[model samples]
Target chain A: MKILIGISSKKYSEPTLDVGMRIASILKSSTTILDVGGKINEFSYKDVSIANELMESWDLDRPGVEVLEWAYNYLIREKYIEKNLNEIGFSKNLLVDKGNGRSEVFLKGVAVKNLSLILRNGDIIEELRDEVQSFEYDLTIIGGSGKRSMAHDLIQYIDSSIFVVNNFNLKQKYRILLAVDDSPGTSKVVKFGVRVAQAFNIEVDLITISKDGDFSEKFRIASSRAEKMMRRSGVTAKVKFSEGELVNTLVDIAGDNHIIIMGTSSQSALTKFFLGSKPLDVMESCNCPMLIVK
Target chain B: MFGFSERSLTTILFWVTRKKWLILSFLLSISFFYFPTPDGLSSEGHRTLIIVLVALSLIVSETIPLPAVAILILIMEVVLGVDTPDGVASSFMSDAVFFIMGSLMLAVSIVHQGLDKRLALLVINITGNKTWRIVMGFVTISALLSSFIGEHTVGAMMLPVALALIRNAGLDTGKATKLSSVLLFSIAYGCAIGSIGTPSGGGRNAIMIGYLAEFGMAEISYLDWIKMTYPMLILEIPIVSLILWKTFTPSQKTMDSSVRKLKVQVAKTGKLNANQLMAIGIFILVFLGWIFFSPIFGLGIVALSGVFLYLSFGLINWKEINRNTNWGVILLFGSAISLGIQMKETGAALWVAGQTLTYLEIIFQDVEIVRWFVSVVVTGLLTNLLSSAATVAVLGPIVLDMGGNPVITGFMTSIASAFAYLTVVASPTCMIIHSTGLITSADYFKAGWKLFIISVILLLIISLFYWPLLSL
Candidate 1:
């Protein structure tokens, strides 16, 4: 599996990097860490580039390079990347221009299958969407700074399963809240939940919510299947049924302690766009980390 | 739902959201097209106004590429019957466009020569150890140099010098600080005010000169431009430095060690080489050409001659120039100038000018103030939103058509466009400084509003009290 992690800076992205790296290590996924800088206006893009080139001649790092360097150091401190005998530290000269406003550096991974760092400029959604489309990654992980429109765009446009590392506490233990339903997408969500449970060696709370407190047989069956998958994966699990508004109930149950794992809404994309889906609402309302399996 | 896949629908939605401006402009254009042409306006002039609205929205929104906007203008001119294909093509490639193209290439060639190191030494050697002196020196040198070369070129060259000083002062270069803000804004604002000193200082000046000459209003020599605007440029240097210093005064009163370190660091680059000398020599020849022979050969051809010499001397290569030059800006300005001319030909400019006077005259009680309001205040604000050149290109013809001395009105519009102090998108120099991550958008206003107000007053004083002495 290929995973993409979006990071902004050294201050706000530490927890995101820690959680993403831990999960990627467990899954042995090929991972890429990306930093998106501010958008340069089109009228001044070329001139800004000329200035940036001049800055390089003066032995200075360009705007986004410093963030990438910080991430590179984080990777080394965690031993996600093996230390090279010849190369001692992160070097700006190693960043290879991949064109289309992307520059990347490759490193040998210790736990992950393959590791790379990428730098891109422009709107975060546009750059992330383009990166995902061009790379075809299976999962994208990002820090949740809680911008509603950014969450909407990420859920609607990015094809990969999204892991928003929101309010993740490294010191506090976290449980998995696997949101199960009768939709066709629930099966994939169940499988992903098991992997996540195994990755963290944490227990799972299998939740099945209904509007009228009437849990149909299919809902029961889906919950049972998810529990069975968790058991098979050696993950401790509990089954719970609730009746309320779907997003509010799930968010209340997850609270700030559980990492919510759920299926994307089975509704049409157009419907989901105008009237947001459950995953998007939960992602927006929840304070804990979330993984919406697409 | 309509036999489209879910992924396809999402993709379409994304495109719709991203390009909502483009769609809005198109709808607005269609609605405006059906409205009856107003009295005193020709049908073609009405259509040209629609095109203007569409182009302005698109350019400001930047929903589409600039080159696409340029092409759209050309297409609409013919399709809307505003101008014939031949007429549109002829208007699109003016000497102003050539000057723009040549100056961009010249900026690339000069920057590629790695003369910024030399520039750094020169600035520090003059400014000495005092931080305030360095700030003033930066403003003075940036203003004077950018007046001859373009603002973008000087902004690019001077940025690293300021950054090096900031870094050597034991501050985080990656983070924003008062020292960095003051120094960076010195370069940006200095370059901005400096661009009005001469026609070659910015593409907008060339565009204004082109309009004046093309409209048969007046023929301004390169030196004539200096005689009129250079005093204002000189007066603005200290004003910019003082405003910036007051707004973002650093705790470091003296950058003694920083200046020493910078000087030592730049010294390691050694003396200028033969190639650097030749590059400087070619630029001198270009400057001489602009001063002495611009009237004979035109500013555009003279600038191109400099680019030719740079190429012939191998000071810079075609590949470097091609990589660095902003072709989209050249194209967009070409189209914008073409639209400006069509505004004149179709009587749209006259109609707009007359209507503006009729409406604003009621409040201002004088045509001169109304004209000044539009040319100075309106153009100044628009330059902060749209590019300075694009502002002048679209607004130049209307201002010239307004009832006043065309020279004064024309000069007012051109110079007012340099008041790009309010936003990062105001000018390339602002964006260049912003790219360092040392200054924020809000920081622009911390000092910008003061300079903006002061500059308007200064321009007013010059136009009313001083410019009448020239009596062009």
Candidate 2:
């Protein structure tokens, strides 16, 4: 499987990348880190002027050189990203295309490619949309806050399943929570979650939103199918049902869970007038990371 | 939720939200049809007035897409019998609309060619990195380029340059970074001021020229336009620059780092590619054509020819041009011209002009200065409300009839219309800059009023001193 990990800004934390690295190594899959740098137009004089004073050139009209230089030194030479890559036993290579440039990094246990994209002057969402559409990825990872948490808004814009990670702890074992509604996509979400949990050698605790007496005959049928799907992967699963405001109840139960997997609602006609998609709302006010699948 | 696909529901919800705005515009427009044909209006004038009112509501409320509103104007004109179908078609498209379309296409093509690295290299080299001086650097480049290439193009070209500089420095956007505000506004206000400089600067200027000739006046040459308005444009630039510099006092003092980065960025391109040189060559040719042969070829023809040259030279591909060029804006512009022409032909413009003239006369009692001032004030205000060109289209005939030295009246209307400072949608240039998401409407209003006051004073001085010196 191939995964696209999104670094919202250049100043991303190690944990986000670490999560991708761990998952990739565990599954022995290909991981691509897309580092999104804001475009040239969005930057002020101060951003490009990081070097002491200014560097004056007479060559006139070439672009991508100075930015490439800055990214090289900042991300590679300064050992900013290099040391981080080395710590994870990843090999880095300078990737250049004529005047424009990026870097490709590979980890030992899995195939990892690093790409730096500077948007210049367009919507980051659109840029990501185009990038994702350009290739196929099973899932995409985004940090929980700032532009990365844009994973919330991006749920509608992108096609792949998304995992918005907040306060991710590599030191702790991941306890998976699969939040399901008796909706069309619920069984699919649970199936995908179970596969992920099986790879990590963990169990998935399936939670459903309902009035909660007997977990409903239909809910039992849905949960039974999901448990059987996990059993196919030799993964154990448990089920719990809740009777409260969906987002609040899920967030409350997510404290002990390291990752929460939720099925996306069928996006009703009135959804546009409302706050946000159910998956994003749960992701926003939650205690841990969330994986949203269709 | 049970049967509908998520995508289908999203599409439905999108249209439903749009329907809300469309419904509001529809109700507001129909409500005003019973307004009993204001005292002096002809029946056609009343119908035209009803269309204008509806157009205004749609534009202001923005319940539908702007292109839809443009189409609505054309449809309303024919349905209301303002003109024959053929007449409406001919009226919808004019040299002014042609110029706007051609120039906008040209702008998108130029930006697509990625020449801003060269522009950035040149600017940073000259500006020497003091943030304010660098802001001035962008100001000078934007204004100068906009004067010839038009603001939409200049604004587009400059957007990435400013963003590169800002993001390179790691400054936050959305008002947290004053430097971001200054750099972006310099482009916005620079485009605004320069757009008033020549006929090529904006669609409004060309539309005004078309109006002057159509309203039965001696033809105003492109150079004659430069002589009449360029000085005022020059005068406004410093005031705009000062206001931007003052209002967005940069949190950082020096931009040496950004300049250095820009220098590196420029160097990365190595040497100019063939496409870059071809783009430059094409722009110079177009600039010379607009300047030397606009009277013969028409500015619109010259601009459209330049677009063909770019295409033929293989400097840009058809797919790229198609993606970058906004056909909707072109349609909107054509409809504006059509609407303006209908306003003139239907007697609605004269009636509106006469009523306005009466009110102004009552207030100022036949003072010539007050007439010009009113023309400037009313056009300026309207320009900020709608698009500058649309404002000129609506007001051009009305003000031309209010009567004074036709050139002065036309110049005041055209030049002041470029002051789209207060609102994002006021000018194409402002809207383009706003699309960058670096500044807010509050930022516009913040720097705008001060410049607006200064501009009014400056215009008064120009009317008193500059116009007479030029024998207007």
Candidate 3:
């Protein structure tokens, strides 16, 4: 599996890096950590590049390189990258221009299967969307500082399962709130939930919700199958059936303590765009981190 | 639902969201096309205005690439029957467009020579260790150098000097501080105010000169331009420096160690090499060509001559110039200038100018003030939103048609466009400083409003009390 992690700054992205790295280590995913800088308007793009070149001559890094260096330090500290590789340090000279405003540096990984750092400029959604579409990553992870407003675009446009690491507090132990439904996506969602449960070494609260307190046989069967999958994967699990609304019930149960794992809505993309999907709605309202499996 | 896959549908939806402005512009243009032409306007003028609206919205929104917008303007001019293909093509490649293209290449060729270290040493030696003196020196040197060379070239060269000083001051170069803000704004604002000093200082000045000549109004020689605007440029230097120092005054009263460290660091690069000398000598020849021979061989050809010399001397290569030059800007400005000429030919500029005077006369009650307001205030504000050259190109013909002395009005519009102090998108120099991550959008307004007001008053004073003495 390939995972893409979007980071912005040293101060706000620590938890995102930690969470993304931990999951990547568990899944042995080929991971990329990306930093998106401010958009340079086209009128001044060439001029700004000229200035950036001058800055380099002065032995200074361009705008986004510092963030990549910080992420590199994090990798070294966590030993996610090979120890000997840290000796050379994070050099801006190592950033290879892959064109279309993307530059990357490849690194040998200790835990993850393959690792690379990418730097891109422009609107966050467009850059992330382009990165995901071009790279064909299975999962794209981002921090939640400003993800609430972008949740719709992230879910709608990005061609990957999204993991928004929202307000993750390291001290608080998190449980997996694996949301199960009768949709066709629930099987894949259950499999991802088991991997996450193993990654975090946490128990799962397998949730099945209905609007009118009438849980259909298909919903019961889907929940049973998810629980069975969790059991087979050696993940500790508990089953809960709720009757309010799907987004409200899940957000309430996963309040600040549980990492919500749920399948993307089976609604058509056009419908999901005009009226948001359940995962997007939950992502907007919920306070905890979430993984919306595609 | 439309027999497409979910991924393709999402991709289409994403494109729609990203390019909503482009869609809206097309719809607006189509709707406006059916509106009856106004009383003073011809059918062709009406169509030209439609194209203008579409181009403005697209350029400001930047929903499409600039080159695409340029091509759209050319296509609309012919399709809308505003002009013939031959006329549009002729208007699209003016000497002013050549100047913009040549100057952009010249800037690339010059910057590739790496004279920034020499520039750094020269600035520090003149300024010494006092923080205030260094700030003034930066403003003075940036203003003087950018007046001769283009502002983007000067801004690019000056950034490293400012950043090196900040880094040597024991501050984190990655972080924004008052020291960094003041020093950086010095370069940005200094380059901005200085751009009005000469015709070669900015592309907008060339565009204005082009408009004046194209409209058969007046001919402004390169020396004549410097004579009219240089005094205002000189006056603005201290004012800009003082405003920036006051707005973002750092706690470090003296950058003693920083200056010493920067001097040592720049010293390690050694003295000016042979290539650097050849580059400077070629640039001086270019400046001399502008002052002495521009009238004989237009400013565009003279600047191109300098680029030729640089290439012949191997000071820069075609590959480097090709890589660094902004071809899109040249295309867009070419399109904008063509539109401006069409505005004049189709009587669109005259109609708009007449309507503006008729409406604004009620509030200001004076035609002169209305003309001045449109040329200075409106152009100033729009320059902050659109690019300065684009602002001048679109607004130039209308201002010239507004009944004042065309030289004064055109010159005022060009000078006012340099008041790009309010936003990062105002000018390339502003964006250059902003790319360092030191100056925020709000930080622009902190010092920008003061300089904006000051510059307007200064330009007014020069126009009223000083410029009449030139008797142009």
Candidate DockQ scores, in order: 0.88, 0.09, 0.89
TM-score of chain B of 1: 0.99
Candidate 3 lDDT tens digits, B1-472:
7899988898899999999999999999999998888898999999999999999999999999999999999999999999999999999999899899999999999899989999999999999999999899999999988888889999999999999999899998889999999999999999998899999999999999988887888889999999999999999988998999889999999999999999889989988899999999999999999999988889999999999999999999899999999999999999999999999999999999999999999999999999999999999999999999999999999999999799999999999999999999999999999988888999999999999999999999999988899999
Model 1 segments more than 4 A misplaced: A85-87
Each candidate: chain B TM-score: 0.99, 0.92, 0.99
Count of backbone clashes for each model?
0, 29, 0
Candidate 2, DockQ score (0 to 1): 0.09
Quote the lDDT for A102 in model 1.
90
lDDT of 1 by residue, B192-261 (tens): 9999999999999999999999999999999999999999999999999999999999999999999999
Q: lDDT by residue for model 3 over A5-75, one digit each (tens)? A: 99999989998999899889999999999999999999999999999999999998889899999999999
Candidate 3 docking: what grade? high
TM-score of 1: 0.99
Candidate 1 lDDT at A232 equals 84
lDDT per residue (tens digit) for residues B85-194 in model 2 = 99999998888888988887787678767676687778788889888888888888888788888876677567667877876687643223788788888988888888
For candidate 1, the share of real interface contacts preserved is: 0.87
Q: Alpha-carbon error at B301 in model 2, in Å?
A: 4.9
Full-model lDDT, candidate 2: 0.71
Badly placed stretches (over 4 Å) of model 3 are A146-148
